[model samples]
Target chain A: MFDSKQFEKDAAEIMARYDQKKAATLPLLHLVQEKIGYIPPEGEQWVSEKVGVAIVHIREVVSFYTMFRTKAIGKHHIQVCTNLPCVLRGAEQVMAYLKERLGIDAGQTTPDGKFTLSSVECLCACEIAPMCQVNDRYIGPLDRAAVDKLLQDCV
Target chain B: MASEMVLSKRLKNPGGAWFDAYVADGGYAAAKKVLTAMTPAQVIDEINKANLRGLGGAGFPTGKKWSFIPKDSPKPKYLVVNADEGEPGTFKDRYLLERDPHALIEGMLIAAYSIGCHKAYVYIRGEYIEPYRRFVRAIEEARKKGWIGEAVQGKWDWEVTVHRGAGAYICGEETALLSSLEGGKGFPRLKPPFPAISGLFASPTIVNNVETLCCVPPIIRNGAEWFAKIGTPKQGGTRLFSLSGHVEKPGLYEAPVSVTLRQLIEQQGGGVRGGKKLKAVVPGGISAKILTAAEIDVAMDFDSLTAAGTMAGSAGVIVMDESTCMVKALLTAAKFFAHESCGQCSPCREGPGRLYKIIQRVAAGQGRRQDLDVLLAVAGNMEGKTICVFADAAAWPIQSYIRKFRSEFEHHVETGTCELGHAYAHH
Candidate 1:
């Protein structure tokens, strides 16, 4: 039901490390997502068969790590830190500003496919509170002004 | 020419927001050294030669772990900084995040190049708002200067993103960290496909401790031989050991691996607070075996600590003075483990709760002597039976405490009260 070429290769590699193939589910999820930019729905069964685990086990692993994106993302994925530290440090206002600035809420993709904005839990750089991550780079400690400057740079 | 170990690179700035100050003090210069001069292989070779280990509890070899990433892989690779500093008695990562944010950025860049990764993530703890803000500004500074992002200074295209973790201690695990970075619940996964080949966004990934990754540029710039010569034969370079609790100087200190615990306490931490007699020390965070004053002479390296039946986990030296009770100390540590259990495995979930209840019973003056055996037996069975070492972490202290301080536990039960033989107030 899916293209198993990349998933098969990754599953084989990750599973080889373990005595049980079933244990490869988590690693496979990570590998598949990295290879394809995101995990397609059909990649689940491909992984389960390769790792010898049930499809349900694969789902549990996928559902567990939020990084395993079910759908495709824009070229740039903007995840704003909305957890307590960031929230306390005005991460909420940053999200609102981004929403107004981008004309999209936290979890929506812009029509241009350049940015997908989402309010994520925390970015762990609490000392640099009110931060947002664009793809693999961080842009932050924003009030309305700094976030706007970041958005301008992104666009 | 001779060099010496000076314990704790943390106070290098000594306090306040000084990004420019860190740069002026030969900080990012090391990173620029690697970025502008060395090739990826040279960096990796130097790290491998130094024999540095991750300070974040797990003690994995830093260079070897990075080398495990498949260089010729057909996928986009990543380097993630595991800055989720949730381990109790551990406040060192926070200082690095706040004080030397640029150092981490430099280290991340070096690590990213060595592992053939242009993309990197700094996975930090959720509660570190102030630290996160500081890092965000620092990262912006680096990016604007073109030290990071899309072929800076005629180098390769690079990306360093900051990813935050929610308020869950379990995310400190590498696998759980990757999960949290991907925007999922902070639950740890069974390892083996280890973060090396399979990590962050799934590509060939290298998940390194913040402190561990921070050591890379220096090793790369100074050469492996220079780096290796700083510490003991096997353990190399300086470490930022967070010294808190009853210490007079109670702050982060940087010394090489050969620095003895006594020197660290006396010279760095300024000895126990208010001249309080040193009773016991939780050498490395809450999980390590507690050491009494006699053992204070031991050095603070990975091997020496292991020989002493504990680890220098995250180098957070938590000192306990005479007034602290053993039961209370063990309980404080146990309560953290119990509360932080991710509810994934039963041995850790039920086991920690049971251990907590058993210890609580003994503390509340409702103990039988056999309860000590019960605690040991339960803790013994729980070890090595979970998806993560959290089980072993939860069990190790109980087993060690009961073995070393069995008298105190027995005394509490016999007297039907705290063994310190004093009236206890609910903390």
Candidate 2:
């Protein structure tokens, strides 16, 4: 499954930075996710072999973290901060708006596979409360208009 | 009184994150002074005299933490900067990383020199992509200026690598941070082999908070007595208090340790939002016990808040106004703990999840009369029984919210709905 020589070379560089091979699990998984958009079963097997760890252990690490997705996701991942601070500042209303806009509930992807909505705990951006992360960008203090504009821009 | 702004002095400056701007504002002068003139013991002594405590929730003294490193150990010592500011309602470290990245870099250099560490890793949270990029840029700038790479300043050898955390709140715990740094799950390790002795990569490591390290540069530049005199005698120096939720001006405020909660809410935070009456305050992060409206007159320092039955944990001041429902609030807090628990221990794993369910039921207007006592009992069992204080932190909001707002909880049970409606339950 691991055919790319460049991918193997990059994985080796990540392993060389750490003292133990087990320590390269997260970085390697992140690299795979970055390269392939999501961790497929083949990617997991690739990581298990690359890190020289058990496949089950690699799966456990992958499943434990929220960022690592086992399945394929939509083109855009919309993570709304629904933790306490955001909740106090009307995160629910924001989530409701996103649900209506996307025609999907939390943790569900749109039928078109355009956007996946998930409520997350504190993105540590409480200064601009009621915030959400659309892919790598942290956009905040969202209202109906802002979320609409965000959705429009996502396309 | 005007709040002192030592760490946040450059917050409002345009282009403050840039290396040249930071240098123009006297950024690495302290670092150069420490490396060129001061000994490791002298640097530690100055910080100890300043009485600066850890700003990452715990109030442990900074210099004493650095001193814990075994001087005679053969292993390459490590200094890990805990930039994983995951505590809810706390956002000060984000400001430090974004606005004043050079300050933290300078502080990291001083800390590395003090602990005899050649290589340091800044384990920043993955979510903080902007701050992470800003920090990495600052490090590169410093490298070009001959401040950070390979025999830093032509006298001592020091290098810094910025590592990103996947997504785990428990990694804010020092040992758990080390575990995550080694590319594993964020699980708290057993003590007696604390980070100072057996930390990242099985070496004597010192994990200091980003804000705690930022304070080091100032303490080295100015005399320790100057930093000591800024705050109370014991706590020493100003701190970044992140004020959010129900306040008119909800943002980060750098204040002295002697600043009262009332002053923070009214003076700094511009009072409650929409002219509403204050209902309650989580004086620190969610881990510290909630404070009633009547109790917010107390000082916000570590010792003062502790004496007032709360703590100065992370200084995350979360204010709630009169329209907020206590039961729903507790439910929100419970859900956070439930989700963030590393789950290595049974109590933390099961306790928060169960507590969250009970609170969820109670908030959804399906509560039993005995449920209140059950909440307290579950919280009691969870405290002090886990590998780390995560369970204890989870239990605190349960115990304190119930104790302080018993009537609000009773109202939820009797009315079969929240006083503030089910707005919080939409998620």
List lDDT for all candidates, in order.
0.73, 0.89
Chain A TM-score of prediction number 2: 0.94
Cα lDDT of model 1 by residue, B1-427, tens digit: 1254322344454563356666665666766677788887777778879878887877778888887988778988888788888665566787778777777888887788777887777777755667888898989888887778887657778877665554577888888877656544567887777777777666788888878877775676567787788878888877777765677766666777788999988888888878989877778876787788889899898889999999888676777777766776676566657667878888887999888787777777888878989989999999999998888988888887778777877888788877455443222
Report per-candidate DockQ.
0.04, 0.74
What DockQ does predicted model 1 obtain? 0.04
Residue B1 of model 2, lDDT score? 31
lDDT of 2: 0.89
Q: Please report the TM-score between candidate 1 and the true structure.
A: 0.72
Residue-level lDDT of model 2, residues B323-347, one tens digit each, is: 9888888888999999999999998
Docking level of model 1:
incorrect
For every model shown, what is its TM-score relative to the native structure?
A: 0.72, 0.97
Give the lowest summed-lDDT range of ten residues in model 1 chain B: B1-10
For candidate 2, give the lDDT of residue B215. Answer: 93
